[model samples]
Target: MRAFKGFRKDLTCLGFQFREDKINRTEEANCVKNGFHCAENPLDCFHYYSDWRNSVYYEVDAGGDLDEDAVDSKISCTEMRLIRRLSLEQMLFEAAVYMVEHPKRQWNYGVKKETGTACNGYGVVRGKNPRAAGEKGDFLLILKEEQNSPEIEEIALINIDGKRWHPHKFYDAYGK
Candidate 1:
């Protein structure tokens, strides 16, 4: 079955180095150990690995005995072939496509669940991040990729909050 797997930037998962040129196999899959683990949905890979900037994803064809979860798309199998490594854009595209079929469980990268507004997100290396010089990263998932608008400011990454963040240094009434 077609599946998605996350790996360190070096192509290692757990401690094993997987080769893209060949089919990889292991002992029969057992929960968190003994097999190659993957997910049916691309975004579900994030629940297991979140270093989006430094990690990589692959389209794998998992064969042989498989153990699948009843609820989510988690799966483990003894055989897998790394079909291809996905680029950042490809990862987004795959996730977006999968989310169309499973809309309710999409990853809330930057949007707030209750308010449906932009929220804090993971930081990125400015030069390596796809966002423009001052543009936001995760906010792009929503419609908030507004450039230099007064809404986004020059605050450091960690201090960015939904409220009281401004290009100016003074605190507004909200004390954020």
Candidate 2:
């Protein structure tokens, strides 16, 4: 799939605060690792990295057939960019949990349960049986061409909520 090149500059994250002490060597190194120069303004730090398409391609469940045991699937670059933007924006604004849908029948993302007008109905509840259409995993993002390693796995598994669920466990349980 082609990489998403455009990032909506207007979609700046609002109300983000940076810690003064956290801006030390480790933070600077992380900034460099994420492809940015550490700026004096904390807003610059947030703005620079806020673009979802900056350094990684987010992995999604992309719900598959019930007969087979897989939900991981590829999404279009456009959909990826939008989902990233939405996730970051929602994370910053509402601080709520968000889940991205696998691209089986369609591509979309939503918050688990939201009272805010903007975040309502971003997700659906599951029945006794798990379905790809309703699979909502953590807001995991993977680096492009990331080699297999524990470090890579840890980095890819980003927690989007207080509670966490691995997509694989669902398939493993139901596939049996």
Candidate 3:
């Protein structure tokens, strides 16, 4: 059996808009002024994946001790389909509205070191409103937690590549 690796935290990506004039302000302050900061440096937003699916062609390479003639005999190809995941775009629009309506709204990551483990997550907050295509007014904010930190109390495994594995088990048997 392979050695068991503990839970790996998700890579957090934040997306938000920024103003042309206020680009010099600190990210935390901008997030706070725009009502995206839930508390302090932690952004007050959620990242969601879109349901739209996209397809792409993938090539596989069989690396082994094969002769030159044998290696050129066959072709390996596959199709991979992925959902158009939502990260910052939607969050920016929503956060902008949220800040407008609730200027004092506190958006903060709820994870704490005292919670017995390290909680990893990604978030995006809007720093400004949207403008014309060529105009630069909106901002895309991103935040990422460290990988392989501590374990959270309740962990939900995400099926990113279409294969499902036991959350608590070593996946050495996969792709066999």
Candidate 4:
């Protein structure tokens, strides 16, 4: 089965180190003891490893005997082959879409802000929000604001040079 797996930034999962494009297998397939685990959706990975900054996710194929979660898409298998790693944008976009589709689960997502705006490349990206018709670029994302309070974690946009900035800093620099 094709699945999404979460691992440490160093590519370690369940105390085992894995390399890209390599197949790793265990002699046993016990979900509670010795088995490989993955989720069908990338977001479900947060359930296992919540530290986004330090965790990396990959696309993989899981074989052998499997145990599936009744509540979610998590699966435990004896064999796993890493397909490739996923990009941060791909992961964050999933969270973004989840934030929009499940507004009631906003607190769980932890990114949408309670204001009207477009997240830019300057504050978040180091450039202004794209304003031209059908203009596409590297980082600007337009999201409908979720009305709430000051508790939601603002999404940070990183510049090409590697500095991370938040939208509030953008407004502060340019006067919102």
Off by over 4 Å in 4: 93-176
- Runs of candidate 2 with Cα error greater than 4 angstroms are 10-138, 142-158, 165-176
Model 3 C-alpha RMSD to native: 23.7
Model 4, residue 131: what's the lDDT? 20
Q: Which candidate is the best by TM-score?
A: 1
The numbered model that scores best in lDDT is: 1
Better of 2 and 3 by lDDT: 2
What is the C-alpha lDDT profile of model 3 across 18-112, one tens digit per residue? Answer: 22222112222222122122211112222122211221111112121212112111211121111122233433333334334444344334222
lDDT (Cα, 0-100) at 50 in candidate 1: 73
RMSD of each: 10.4, 17.7, 23.7, 9.0
Q: Model 2, range 12-130, lDDT digits (tens) per residue? A: 22232212222111111121122212222111223335444442221111111111112212121111112232244333222211112111122122211111111221222222222
What candidate 3 gets wrong by more than 4 Å, as runs, is: 1-88, 110-139, 142-176
Candidate 4's displacement at residue 125, Å, is 22
- Worst 10-residue lDDT window for candidate 1 reads 125-134
lDDT for model 2, on a 0 to 1 scale? 0.23
Model 1, 1-176: lDDT tens digits are 98899999998999989999989988788655578899888756766777677788999999988998654688999999999988655654565455444444534343222122222232221111122111133321221211442132222222333343422232211222
Give the Cα-based TM-score of candidate 1 against the true structure.
Answer: 0.62
Candidate 1 Cα errors over 4 Å, as ranges: 103-135, 142-176
- In model 2, the Cα lDDT at residue 87 comes to 41
